[model samples]
Target: MRESQPRESGAQAILEKYDRESQFRLNLGKWGLIVTFLGVYLTVFHLYTGYFGVLPSQKQGAIHLGTALGLIFLLFPAKKGMQKHQKTVPWYDIILAFLAMYISYHKVIFLDSILQSRITGYHPFDMILSIVGILLVLEATRRTVGLPIVIVAGITILYTIFGKYIPTQLLSHPGFSIDRIATNLWYQESGVFGTPIQISSKFIFLFLFFGVMLVHTRIGAFFNDLAFSLTGRYTGGTAKAAVSASALQGMVSGSSVGNTVASGSFTIPMMKKAGFKPEFAAATEASASTGGQIMPPLMGAAAFIMMEYLGVDFSTIMLAALVPAMLYFTGIFIGTHFEAKKRGIVGLPKEALPNFKKLMLRNGYMLLPLIVIVGTIMIGFTPQRAAIIGIVSAYLISLIRKESRLSLKQTIYVLEEGARVALPVIAAVATAGIIAGVVSITGLGAKFATGIIALSGGILPFALMLTMVACIILGMGLPTTANYVVTATVAAPALINTFGLEPIAVHMFVFYFGIVADITPPVCLAAYAGAGIAKANPFRTGLNAVKLAIAAFIIPYIFIYDPILLLVDVTIPHFVLAVVTAFLGMLAVSSAMIGFFVSNSRIWERVLLMLGGLLMIHPEVYSNVAGFLLMAIVWLLQRNRKNGEVSQSAAV
Candidate 1:
């Protein structure tokens, strides 16, 4: 077994580095209460909206953005390290916070009146507000989501102005006046109040609030325990448990790093103890945790954005995601099993494993809320209604268990925490609105699609490759939610319009690659955090994570090639066929990648398996047959090798 150190820095250090949610509330007592009050207020506002639909879209968006922006300024420091030990709000931040409030309140004060005035042009006050709003949103985005998105948005704004000078007329615009640009971005429905922000305001917060409530009620722990009990007695149990546990946890939790730290702290050490290398252990946790974003039921807040973008119900996305997401986790599990076989590792001792039956009996109630949510949604309840009921039912279930029950104060904290956790998303979504607006106003989405199609020579495969690369690059520092919004806005149109691909397929395609960035090198935030906990080198861990998640990289292409994988335009027979071949493809790919199947694979065997998997993964019957034959050949060879070795041993 390779020697591995315990985490050098504790959870605090890992969180501060990777998670925006770990920021200090405040040092001053009064300021702390004030911040808490604001958080609670935001949560309540969303809850109120959910229960009783209040106000028009613009008004609701204004209230939501205003509240979130104010809290963001109050909570996140202007400078990073300054907030480490300091508690008091800086005077500048306080001013900025008030300015954010003023900006949010602008829609309330001016929007209806602007409409009533019948004036299409920007007044002086409107211009100032627009300029201030843009600057404040940029700074707030910098403080919350980091500089990548801010820089992107800033460049877009510059392009919106000076773009006409460029030779290309498609993306470039006739130079716009400052007043016109400000008026459009600030006041237009297409700007900060677009679908992204609108969805963020309406649905994302409610779901996140429910998720926080679910966590406070101990569903996360139940999930981890549940996974452990089910998988702990199997080969490579600890690592398998990580895959299972991360999938279970991800169904409810939205944040990748949060889930990584939450589950990795338990699974990574167990994997290391089971004799996995530190890099492999860390990478396994990262890959598994990052997968939660793609998992169903609660597949992060981005799914809500997709709901709006695709104009489909949540069930459609959930059903579509079911097969591919499972294949992703199964691939990881297979890799772990093979790695364990290669290392001569075994499952936990019977005495060390949790009792699966007892765990289910004791903690089964913890799943009631999820069941209620899933059932209600499937049975035709609105998602918000389902979530509200889930929260209520979950709270009631919590009352039955001492460990899971929440006190009144604790419940309030849950609400506050939920809203606090959503701040960065609010900022990202609103700022994403700016990008969407720019794309819409400048016709950049169409222009980019045309250019990419031209570059790709109108080939579907080439268009997909270009989109995948774009998603991976854009997703480097952004959250999955923001990553998808930006990618779909800029890149999805290329695949859909250029290749005449389905919207859902293109969206899912970009979404998968965007999320793969979390486990991809150089900026794999989830992988880095997992490595921090496993005390391994971050880059190597990220690479290993990429290897473990090979299925995610490949499965998207499968779904894109055959929308049957996405349950689009599908018959039952076709869906099953697509699913079976895809599953075999995953198995084949995992076998080749891990260099093991029925027994250890030889080099030529591995190559054969790879060839077969690629063929089967494509949706052609002849190719599938050819691929299966190649795999069957490899499997028989491996079996023969194992038999020969056994015979030699018997002769000895």
Candidate 2:
């Protein structure tokens, strides 16, 4: 297939614009600095309220409005004559800035008194203020993200009013009055200020701030060096290094496309140098980078949303994600290995790989921030506190070396950059909150779950398959975090209530499928991003990524079926058996996908391996034994083929 050059260049230009602008060129630092400080203040205020629950509803709405407005002032393009230009803030920006501060101050100081009387008459000034605030938020939404999401939010608002007239089984509601809808969406916690926004302010922002600190401390470079030291001398080593480094970066980056572009620039070129085709190299990096969302420690903002929705601890969610994440990356690593072997490509020169001992001696302290984060969380510190500590540790560790130390100016840059990256995420979460609020207020969540259950005929596997399809479809268009939020609220509950799966397992199932959408067709943004770098066919790169990540597509279903793999409802013996079986199953799946195991595989062997993999994934002891036997037979056939080759040579 021919690559579409127009789409590739358009995407490249967008990414380059963001990357270049992130550096604050053309004297935009002053506005960047002001907007960034507002972002920090907003984040801190939300965190405080989240921990103490002191803020009233009207005040919360005001803060939300102010933050949304500031984000707009920071991100929106200004009109310069005939052309729309991206430039520094103008005078109107300062006006908007002061307005934001005034809104926040008014809410913090005066809104509490107004809320004291339940029967207080509606003041004309209050009504006007509220309408203006809502309009500002809508405009901010349009400027920060594209128009599609704003349109979706508008439809949801319309649905809240006109939904009663719609005739459908899945759509049933008595509808709400405009005042009630506005009150619920604007003045209450259920709509714009819902759990999505709460999670963003409290957890996502802190972690995002932590990621920025780590980047400033040179931890990103440290990960790259460590990945090179570990894997750069193996077959398809550069690709493997990309996979490993991306996995580490994913834990912190919270973005699949950003992580792909960041890691792919270095790894894709190296893979190409090692004889990998540009498209395949791009696809490999794309697939691996997308998996980072599923990796543990910090599986994007979705993990926090899951924890909030499930009322589970962060550690439990992280623990459950370990095996699935490992399997996803293992699949990518194995696929890269076999591809290199098939093409007879060699590894990088030994001298090219980083010297592990020397590198560690110089930059070992960079790892301490992550260690502190994990240790603090495990010891029962709140994730917020742990994140604060992590950020501090990142800065302190950077001081160990003069080159890595962050100057005050550099620190401000990190703060501003973090805010810039966080703006869209905050918007996404806040907008999603409205959807969730509507679902909750209308009991649409239960109705949606019930409908899916009935459609699946109450069968677990069929229901899971339907859920996976739904998640992928949603993920294709939405960000991973938003996708997970929507899926978990609507579909995950069905799995738990109808199928009796553990809550953690159900949420994780939805989360995995949501992330896999990045590599799926139609809207595979990660693969498309990679194709831009490789100058490859976007669809073909996406197809290769799907093939390479086959195990990710299957492993979630495995854990869903045999909950023991998730470390739920299991004895020690069962846990061991499940792990061993799942490990072997992943190997079979990888081998089948790669079409190589000791030698080139025939169609029959590939079929057998696939069946063996599926069988091993099932919980039945009989299936396990059968899968082991099938694998043994394949091993013997390959050995016999090798011996027959030697015998033929001797006879000749």
The best candidate by lDDT is 1
Residue pairs in clash, model 1: 27-87
True-vs-predicted CA distance for residue 70, candidate 1, Å: 1.0
Q: TM-score, each model?
A: 0.96, 0.90
Model 2 off-target regions past 4 Å?
1-33, 36-65, 78-84, 90-110, 113-139, 646-652
**TM-score of predicted structure 2:** 0.90
How many clashing pairs does model 2 include?
A: 0
Writing each residue's lDDT as its tens digit, candidate 1 over 84-157 gives 56647777878888888887787887777766543655578877888898788878888887888888888888
Writing each residue's lDDT as its tens digit, candidate 2 over 288-320 gives 888888887877888998888888788877788
- CA shift of 643, model 2, Å: 4.1
Instruction: Give the C-alpha miss distance for residue 380 in model 1, angstroms.
Output: 1.5
